[model samples]
Target: MKIFKYLILLVSLSVVMTGCEKEFLDTEPASSISAEQVAETPAANEALVNGIYANLRTYGVGGTTAHTDYGHRGITAGLDNMSNDVVLNNFNWYIFFYNYTGRVQTSSRASLIWNTYYSVVADANIVINGLGTLENRTAEEDALFGQALALKSFALFNLVRIYSPSYIGNESAPGVPVPDRLTFDGKGRGTVQDVYNQIIPDLEQAVTLLEGFNRSSKQQIDQSVAQGLLAEVYLETGNWAEAASAANAARTGYGLMTGEEYVNDGFDNIGNQEWMWGADIDSESSTVYASFFSHYDSFLGGYAGALDGYKLIDANLYSMIPETDARKDVFVEAGNEFGFPPLSNTKFVDATSSFEGDYLYMRSAEMYLIEAEALVRAGQVDAGIDVLVELVSSRDSGYERPALTGQALLDEIYLQRRIELWGEGFAWFDLKRLSKPLDRTYEGSNHRDFGKFMFPAGSNEFLFQIPEDELNSNDNIGAGDQNPS
Candidate 1:
């Protein structure tokens, strides 16, 4: 059954020729064909690209768990557990991630993340490389080619971020191998700078190519998506001005959601104007136990809130949210109706009790936060504060722009970011980039295991080891090349 499922996914990768309607890529192909053979026509090429998006939600890489809707939710859960913001109240599937145990060079989760992303990258390369074979290229073809590049860049961007050290003074550090084409030959690790160099240009080209192309659905990548990704890349590389500019470019057509909309709605709808990129999980196509809601949703999830285990928001951070802030209501306070732990999150729930909920990949609010952070880092303190005030005031009607500067102002902005983007998967990355220590020893902390409570800044546990399979199979990477255990 597993092999049959994989075969179906592989065949579907080349069979995306449905029609004008923007729907999920759930159509099974009549037969299998090589990716190169699949991109012969414009429709075929477009389908191939669409399949990449579909592959994100289906069984592969992060999607190994049955019915787990393994794409963004799987990645998000793992990433969030690695940080201090979200805590596991009981031993669950993600307990290893929460404790940073079993994340060794050979761990299955690490391997899944590595392999699944590379699979996307490999298919994307086929589409990108095959674009030149077309006889008469149109804007659509250019857009397809552009989307392929952007997707490829996105996969590589996340891979490098997870597998390598921060680019800050760590440019020379060993990073994941930069694969430009689909091949089995082993390639050695490159420097962290090498991967960034590749990612930046690919996204820049994608932004240019996708300029006038109309997308069938929000699931598809557009100019704004490329720009948003570029902004994040710039922020990671410490290119403050470019990050701010790219963020503003990405925010052109989107606006922040009203406080009422945020609190009342379960955040399962991708149609919300605040969402920039997302996976629209149709009810019929829902992956029951494997879906995002099954894991993250308080009322609907299998592991969180009123379920087998609980997902708790960091108590210290929760205390920082002012009562005036509407976002504070997203989490259930201790002694609330749910009987959940203090600061247990209720931010995500399926509209019905079912596990069918759209998974958000990126949002406009992230862009606003990125712009603010970039501006502040670039020495435009007041301008940055103004941007933040604009966002915060919307969530907290009584918010008065606090008088803050220097590190204090930066800290405040970071705090707002944590509150605004919690569970959306920024916590771990932020902690790593800021070189912050993980200390879960505070009062009311949910992390009870002493052995896993604190890891200092620059600890070996910060980066995931290259999968043991890769080290064993690839000649370029060996045991010595593994991240510190």
Candidate 2:
């Protein structure tokens, strides 16, 4: 709560609320101004919305920490390492995340994840709450309002997914706090069902408000982005029919990138046609050594390369990828032995030698998979297979419509998702929602600790504990509220 209060003060004082600058969010700290005294014009209001987008890039989630990316990049890397798809070569940085050893109630990563997201949520709440005070609203104002709502919903959804149990049957389980107003007091955690209930309405409002609003940048939220988020939320809650409809709607104007495009492109550019939403990091805004490319890009002599390539693709997963699939070449087949796994992932690399590379948040391929899975879950097995065919054939020309039904079809979809998404960050979330076991005790597993690697289904490690800072500072949240250590 203290952290939240401090951030609110900084935001209120730093951001200029009067005349709008094209890169208003990029400006350094200036004279303090009251929120009520600014944003009177559409341009100023637009600048306020732009502040949300800027926060999405450089706020708690995107900032650099010591040896780690520590933003969305860090979260994704941690989640990938937690799963069996990614293997760490050394017990160096991120070893705690890979091994799940120090993910306690007071862990730094847990604190960063929690604080960063709520900071975004708090900013979004200010924009959303302050919108009603102005007079003669235009379409521009409505668009900004919708974007703020969607951003808030996105942050809340992420927080709940990490801190609470799966929503399948544990809807009543304790979830992260839902702070709708711009207040400093700790609101305390809500039930998983309560958070989802709040999230659904925000997304619904976002979809309606964003209709026909052509966003100038991929960083901004639009109708498609809102629908995509809603589809994901619906899928998580097991609303199969609604999930399918929303997923299909979300893929309206987007198409899957060709296999060649996927392999050749660095997967770092925000301008890719397949990318739905992303952060366009440039040299000016790059975190240098602590950037996404520095960690994940194997070609760069950064963290991944310095340790003789720590971010490796699991051998089991690498073997499953068909030789015919171009994606199979994404990792080193065999050659260098860094005293660990040989199949290191080379899927991500910077466009240049510099550490600057755009970060991807969402893509169209995920929508197709979402639609396919939702269709199968809704009892439309054949329809699901057809949708899967469209996505799979695009990636692997040799792939044919297989003679499979029921769980087999679902399994194939899951496998395709694993291969397609890979380090783009869906593995741990999928494992959580599907209640899958994490068995890293295989003979050739690259996990540093065998004892902590094999997490069974429904393990307590699935939920991250609430940070100790929040527990000690927030009156409503205490030690009893923490997730199992």
Candidate 3:
């Protein structure tokens, strides 16, 4: 049952494709088959691109995946053990508590994540390579190239962070399998530097491709998306000035949502088209709920608003949030209705008629926060603190966290990020990037630690073990592909 549950995520990945086939035209168009035949048309290209997004919701190895949603079990449990949050359930939360030897195989989540990231990249590759072949490529084709590049870069960036440790001033960290922009075959593990190198080029090209390209709605990636991603990259690389500038640019196009808008109907996500980038979910087409299969949804008794005691928010972080903030509602917490639900962490699961919600990849708040953080990091302390204070003060009403700078301001901003971005998958990413410790706790959370890490800050607990299959099939890597030591 332990391993079998992982299969559920894989099953979800398979269904992301629109299985309904469209019959070919009855005409005599058998002249030849070209890559353009698949992507030159909007419908075919859209379907191809959609397939990648669908697969992205599966579990593990980075960025956006079903793991973000499903990990709630392991995550809730893991956090609970460390005292960060309270677990509402105990079904199987202990799996992560210790390290053990198990034959490695590619997980549905890892492979799907790999496939999604690359397939999307491949789609972008197709856009890059097939543009000339396309019947009417035009500026839209170039815009897609930019979108594809940004998407691929984002996925690669996340994949690298999950599979590899922080740069740590050394270049040898075992990053995930990095693929060449032109290949379709699976490659072995690339070094952290190798993976990092691939991203900047793609993003740089994407920025160039998306010059002046603007398409509203977070579902479609455009110039702003490119800028937002670049800012994130710069921040990660410690290029504070460039990061701040890029983030500020993205902020120009978007910013924090209004109090009411922040808590949309129930889809309670940063996406919902307000996203700088996000997944478009169709109830019929997306079985996100099936993969999520959690108590946080409709069954728990009301996590955010109701719960079954399956998951909760971190106590430390939870305590830090001011009472006046409207964003505080994002977490239900232990004392809310029964105290078992702990913190709500419902920033992503915004479903009114259902327990599910449309997911977002990036949002305006992130851009705003990035700009603020970048400014502080770049020595623009007052400028940066102002940004953080504005957002927090607005959210918390009467609260003001002081004009903090250095570690204090950075920590302040990060806590809000965790609270604001919790459940949407940024928790692990942030921890991994900053190399923090995981310390989650709960009454009945299912996941446990590999060793002694707590809730949301464990080492590889932040990253995932590379699925074993790739190592066997390719023989270029090994069982424990990530979270080294």
lDDT of each: 0.78, 0.77, 0.54
| lDDT tens digits by residue: candidate 2, 1-485 | 64566666346435323222244344333343346533444544455567656555553342236455345666776777788788877765667678775467767777777766776687777677677556766898888888888988998888898899889999989988987565756777879999999899989999998999998788788999999999999999999999999999998888787888788887988898888987777655666766667777787878777755458787778878898788877777665553324677768978777876888888989999999999999999889889999998887878989688888888899999999999988998999998988888888765555323678988998888988888888888888888988
Q: TM-score of predicted model 3?
A: 0.76
Per-residue lDDT over 1-485 for candidate 1, one digit per residue giving the tens place of the 0 to 100 score: 11112323344463333221245443335254455555665666676788777667664444355333276567767788888888777777677778786468767777777766776676677677678457776898889989999998999888888888888889999988876454434678879999888899989999998999888788999999999999999999999999999999999899888888778778888888899998777755566776677777878746564455667788788889999899999988768986677677788878867776887899999999999999999999888988999889989988898698888988998999999998898998898788888889876665747324788987788898888777777777778888898
lDDT of 1 at 280: 78
> Each model's TM-score?
0.92, 0.93, 0.76
What candidate 1 gets wrong by more than 4 Å, as runs, is: 1-22, 25-39, 66-69, 132-136, 182-184, 450-452
lDDT of 2 at 250: 91
Higher-ranked by lDDT: 1 or 3: 1
Poorest stretch of ten by lDDT in candidate 1: 1-10
Q: Rank the candidates by lDDT, best first.
A: 1, 2, 3
